[model samples]
Target: MSLIHALVAQGSTIMAEHQAGKRDFSQATQTILSKIPPNNSKLTYVWEQYLFHYISEGGFTYLVMADDSAGRRMPFTFLGELQRKFIASPTASSSTTSLAPHALQSTFGPVISQLMYTYNTSPPTDDLARAQSELAQVKDIMVQNVEQILSRGERIELLVDKTDTMASQATAFRRGARTVRRQMWWKNKRVLALGIIVALVIVWIIMAQFCGAALRCGSN
Candidate 1:
């Protein structure tokens, strides 16, 4: 599965969450959540073969863990969807000051489960499956190695001047393949259109020679 786990939290207090597999991510997720700055941000933390993507805004963080093969796009898109849904829910109106841990679990836990299931089962291969136009901004989001977040002196707020080289190369390859496919499709279309036109012209020429353009002739 692409999406393995997801959670909504206020600071280090998890309000609600969903895990899609048998693996326990509780300890790892809590550790990561504690490190997230209590401010507006979007980032991906690469650890081993998995990617932890999170969006922190309005004192709440929406996070999703996915296999790196899912790439940067899909997980962030899932977070975007999760954020939108959270904003619309009554849970958003609750006072963050008085909120208790896992308070929304009873109410919003099912929502997270459904969303996780949807995104995990349905890969975002088309525009329709995408969360929204917001996905267009995903490329601009910062991607950092997990070590960056764990290191004491390292800057956590580094600019997105570099992306994971392997992921970038893979993206480039996919784009190149798409461009070639589109060019070939158009080339074939133009060739077919030109052939049809040439065949029509040849038929007209034969008709003109046999029957004359302006002179209507009877079969003799």
Candidate 2:
């Protein structure tokens, strides 16, 4: 993979460049970019025996200059991988955050090298076939994950509702228990008062009987 140049850009500004000569590569990238329109996916052209391709994501554009023998699709695949790495980088919170050349290199140099090695260094004769197979597998996995999330969404909502209902019922039960306890306490107090009143009345009657007996004896 004779990839002579690559760069990360913020609009027209070259934030980072990779090649034998950083300044020369950055200049070449800018020169190539000056001749092309943004997001020109359907269009590709050769410049000085080097094929250039670009993918614009957000405010940042990723460009690659490769040897003519390098097929058209590899650059794009390279751009995709690079853009994903750039966006997922910790220093880059968003596409708007432009990383300087050294910062970009420090963050993604190893990844860039690995991708180029895997895809550019003596790649299979049928790179397109391999890319297509990998793409199909990715598509299938995404579809399954989305379906699972959709199904689980309903269950999550139901679980939330059940949790809320249980919380409300528990509060109501606590209130009811307090009320029952208070009522029982008052009822017991009333029973104790009634028993004391009855005992006092019985004592008064016994004293009156004794007094009458003494009066009768005095009269005799």
Candidate 3:
């Protein structure tokens, strides 16, 4: 199966298991949260903030059940909301650009492309919205940083290399988008052909009845 198909199938199985109560929601949520890297302290903090806002806005209660020695659940909705607001605000837009100059230049290309892919799949109106918004913000920051580095007239070769990498990523994204569009077109064509076949059958029946009526009139 294709990667997309495999992902869909896995998602279906997970949903089914959850609905059946074989998988607990909290456990699943924690599993997802655990997969995020904690080493990138700044990014980790931003991500946690975004998650808090999303859950709060949806009026969902989330508890870090394992963290508290007293086994107490704390309301985290407000913190999440604040994080969401901060991320969405224009002031927080340039935060990612403030990384070490070398780090920014070295990782910006791949990171931007990955962020693009993430944005493409994100919903504009949900918790994913914050991610999508952040990706745009990050892209802008990267662009500005690249401009600044190029202005200093140093590391010209590195800039060229990064530009080439970005070009390849854009090409790949376009190819994937085109393939999806073609598949959708083919599906629509099949549906249209079925409708045309049904219409032709109806027309054939009508024509046959009309011919019979004319023959009867002529014979009379």
Model 1 stretches astray by more than 4 angstroms: 123-140, 147-220
Identify the leading candidate in terms of lDDT: 1
Task: Provide the global lDDT of candidate 1 against the true structure.
Answer: 0.80
Writing each residue's lDDT as its tens digit, candidate 1 over 80-183 gives 77999999999888845757888899888999999888888885566335644566644646776764433443233332334366789989999999999999
Give all TM-scores, in the order shown. 0.61, 0.48, 0.24
In candidate 3, the residue pairs with backbone N, CA or C atoms under 3 Å apart (3 or more residues apart, or in different chains) clash, namely 52-80, 53-80, 53-81
Model 2: how far residue 111 lies from native, Å: 2.7
RMSD of each candidate? 16.6, 18.7, 22.2
- TM-score result, candidate 1: 0.61
User: In angstroms, how far off is 67's CA in candidate 2?
Assistant: 1.0
Expressed as tens digits, the lDDT of each residue in 1-220 for candidate 2 is 5666777777676665566323244444565455444543323445445566676656677777777787665666677677887888864574455545455566556666666666666655475666556555542211000111124232111112334679999999999999999999999999999999999999999999999999999999
Better of 1 and 3 by lDDT: 1
Q: What is the C-alpha lDDT of each candidate?
A: 0.80, 0.61, 0.33
lDDT of 1 at 194: 100
All candidates in order of TM-score, best leading:
1, 2, 3
CA shift at 103, candidate 1, in angstroms?
1.0
